[model samples]
Target: MKEKMLSFHDVKHIYHTVRGEVTATENLTFTVEKGEFVALIGPSGCGKSTLLSLAAGLLTPSEGEVSRRGSIGYMLQRDELFPWRTIEKNIRLPLEVQHRLDSESLERARTLAEKYGLGEFLQSYPSQLSGGMRQRAALIRTLAFDPDVLLLDEPFSALDYQTRLLVTQDVAKIIRSEGKTALLVTHDISEAISLASRVVVLTKRPARVAAEHELCFDGENDPLRRRENKQFSEWFELLWKELNA
Candidate 1:
């Protein structure tokens, strides 16, 4: 059996605002196994982002437990690349922050940039790169530390439709190639379906697991190719109804 990398057992989170306490999730339970890709989707204001925050340890559950076996890397919606920093320096930020910027680690970061087609642009600033390239750089930065699991919070929502499609494919390919487990929170059902091996749907406010779908597509694992599958529309409609219902 695959070792579990992250698990949420009967988790609940309540935010204490001056207005009052607001529950975001209740009795949320799920497990992300080693190298698994799971996408989370739900209605607007359904606390989807909150789930990623909790998983990243940015917030603690008010009840139950959020357990993680290894380090987590978070990729936000915005690339969040420092405009003043070169792509190389941006990708190296994680190592520097962790105080692990040894020569070996720096070499590994450079190799990853090259391997992912950013070899020529390492010296380029974020402004010099396209949105997709910047997001790629952001991902490379996240991976520089070799985090065991990646928590993606709408990482592609900022891009144009075409760029979003292309970047999601690129991100999916890179994540799979590295054998990394990822938990993504996306409002786009199609995006979730294309990139995830499994989809977890949450209910409205005070979110809870409403449904789970295990996806299977023949042939290539590419997100673009997966979108063309007959089952893609089927799954999309199914999830659409689940979200609306």
Candidate 2:
């Protein structure tokens, strides 16, 4: 059996504001298996971001459980790279935060940056790189700590349509190559269909799983190529109906 990297079981989360208590998720349940990429899709204000926080342990569940078996890395909607920091410094930030900054670790980070075509740009600042490259650097920073699972919260949502496609391809390829389990929360159905081997759909606020699907593309793992598959539209339509219904 595949090892489970993360699981959310009957989780309920509430935000207590001065106005009142607001429940974001109720009885949310899902699991991300080792080396698997799972995309989460739902309507607007459906607490998808809340779910990522729950997975990352940034929020406590009001009810039930949130379980994780390994370290987690998070990449938010924006690249969140400090503009003043050079690409190399941005990548090494996590290592410093985790206190894993050492010659060996720094060397590994450098190797990763170079291996992924960011070597030449290491000395460049975030402002010096294109949007796609900034996102790439953000991901590498997240991976610098060697987290076992990745929680990507619409990491490509901020990019233009064309850049989104290319960045998704780059990110997915790197995640697969590194064998990291990933849970991506995206509003873009097409993006989800292209990147996920499995997808979990959530209902509107007070989020909960409404449907789940396993995607098959004859072992095609490339997100860009997957979009070209005939089945891509089929999955997209199914998900659209599910979300609308």
Candidate 3:
């Protein structure tokens, strides 16, 4: 059996604001197996971001359980890299914060940046690079910590359409090559279909699993190639109906 990297079991979360208590999710259940890419999709205000936080342990479920097998790396909608820090420095930030910074760890971070085409820009600040480059640096930074699973919450949503496409391709390759389990929360049906091995669709507010599908592409995992597949449109149409339904 495949090892389960992360799981949400009958989860319920309530947000207590000055206004009142809000139920974000109810009885949510799902499991991401090792090295699997799972995408969570739902309508607007369906508490998708809340789910990401729950996985990252930023929020505790009011009911049920959120479980993980190992450490997690979270990539936010924005790169969130400090402007004062260079790409290399940003990538090393996590390691430094975790007190895991050392010769070997530092070399690994540099190697990842180089492997991902950021070697030449290691000293460049976030402002010196385009939105796409900064996002890549953010991803490399997340990987530098060597987390067992990745939680990506719309990491490419900040870029232009063209940049979003390119960065999505690169991020998909990086995650697959590194053989890491990942949970991505996205509102885009096409993005979910292209990037994930399995897609979990949720209902509107007070979220619950609406549908779950295991994507099939005949061994093709590249986001760009998956977009080109004949099944791409079919999968899109199916997911689209699911979202609207």
Candidate 4:
């Protein structure tokens, strides 16, 4: 088994609002092993993002603990690529900000972009790229920092269905090839089942763990193949029932 990388111990998150305190996540507890791909799925407003925020260290838990032993790279629903920066510049931004940019790292970044089919667009600006390409750039930027844990919040939501599928396949291949640990917050049941080794389902607002499943399939971890698997729809329906229950 992989070593534990991120852990939430009875975590509780609350928001202060004009009306009063609002609980977002309550009594959540889980652990993600290093290099493990875990997915968070639930009904809308189920605190999936709130759980991700705590895991990313963007927010602190009001009670209990959310802890990570390594650096985190966050990819939001929006690509959020800077218009002023070229693809190369954007990918290098993380390293630059962390003061880790050097000739060797630049070379590594260039290689990553090239290997991922972004080489030809290295000098292109965000506006010059397609939505899919921009999302790739966003992911490249996240990877340039060499983060051990990637927190993805609906990274493909903005794309159309076809684009979303293609991007999901690409992103899954990229993450697996890089051997990075990922915790994704998504509402798509098929997506979670396809991309994750484990799925953690949560209850509606003031979320708690509702269910967890470990996926065991017979072939390459490709989204397309997973979708075609005989067990795929079964798992999806099961999750749907849990979410709607």
> Which numbered prediction scores highest in lDDT against the true structure?
3
Per-model TM against the reference:
0.98, 0.98, 0.98, 0.98
Cα lDDT tens digits, model 2, 42-159, are: 9999988889998999888999999999899999999999988899999999999889888999999999999999999999999989999999999999988889999999999999
Error of 3 at 175 (Å): 0.7
TM-score, candidate number 1: 0.98
Each candidate: what lDDT? 0.93, 0.93, 0.95, 0.92
- Kindly report which residue pairs in candidate 3 clash with one another: none
Give the CA lDDT, 0 to 100, for residue 3 in model 4: 88
Writing each residue's lDDT as its tens digit, candidate 1 over 1-245 gives: 98999999999999898999999999999999997899999998998888998999989899999999989999999999999999999999999999999999999999999999999999999999999999999999999999999999999999999999999989999999999999999889999999988899999989999999888786457898888888899999999999999
lDDT of 2: 0.93
- Which is better, 1 or 2, measured by lDDT? 1
Instruction: Evaluate model 2: give its TM-score.
Output: 0.98
Candidate 4 or 1, higher TM-score: 1
Between prediction 2 and prediction 3, which has the larger lDDT? 3
Report the CA-based lDDT of candidate 4 relative to the real structure. Answer: 0.92
Per-residue lDDT tens digits for candidate 3, residues 149-192, read 99999898889999999999999999999999999999999999
